[model samples]
Target: MRNLQGWEIFVLLAVVVLLFGAKRLPDTARGLGRSLRIFKAETKGLREDDAKDATKDTTVTTAAAEPVVVEPRPIESGVAQAPAAGAHAVHRDAADR
Candidate 1:
């Protein structure tokens, strides 16, 4: 078991070569190569998918900034503050046009 002579290895090779002929060896190698390529491509695709999922779209908000609030005034207050309120009638041209 420790030391294997050259003749022993030659005998093993001869037996394997006979069991699987030389003509069929190339086909088997090609099939093995194609399988490995497909496996690598699938692994790469899964890695890209994982990366896309890792960098997501939802915004990340820190609690440091204070929120800004906007308030809407009543309709009567807006009409009273308007400069042209007395000069122009409300919705007068809209009905004529």
Candidate 2:
């Protein structure tokens, strides 16, 4: 659409003034400006945070990290193996009552 002519702009302003009244116009504009300012600041902060994360993801660690290896113990037949450290042993007799 083409830009509004002078009279069209005047008419739009008149309509807004009539709808909201003269007294409320400044307050409404101020509130709208504050909202836009806050929105802009938050978006900027998010962009900065994303940039930081991108940098963090690109950096290489100097020291080589070694993978941990765990060996499993062989299970013996016909013997009740005691529970490993920090293991909770459940008694079936208590649950049956």
* Counted clashes in each candidate structure: 0, 0
Question: Which pairs clash in the backbone of model 1?
Answer: none
> Where does model 2 exceed 4 Å of error?
58-97
Instruction: Please list the C-alpha lDDT of all candidates, in the order they appear.
Output: 0.73, 0.81
TM-score of 2: 0.59
Model 2 sits at a Cα RMSD from the real structure of 15.1
Which residue ranges in model 1 land beyond 4 Å of their true spot? 1-13, 58-97
Candidate 1 accuracy as TM-score: 0.45
Write out the backbone clash pairs for model 2: none
Worst 10 residues of 1 by lDDT: 85-94
C-alpha TM-scores of all predictions: 0.45, 0.59
Best by TM-score: 2
Error of 1 at 89 (Å): 54
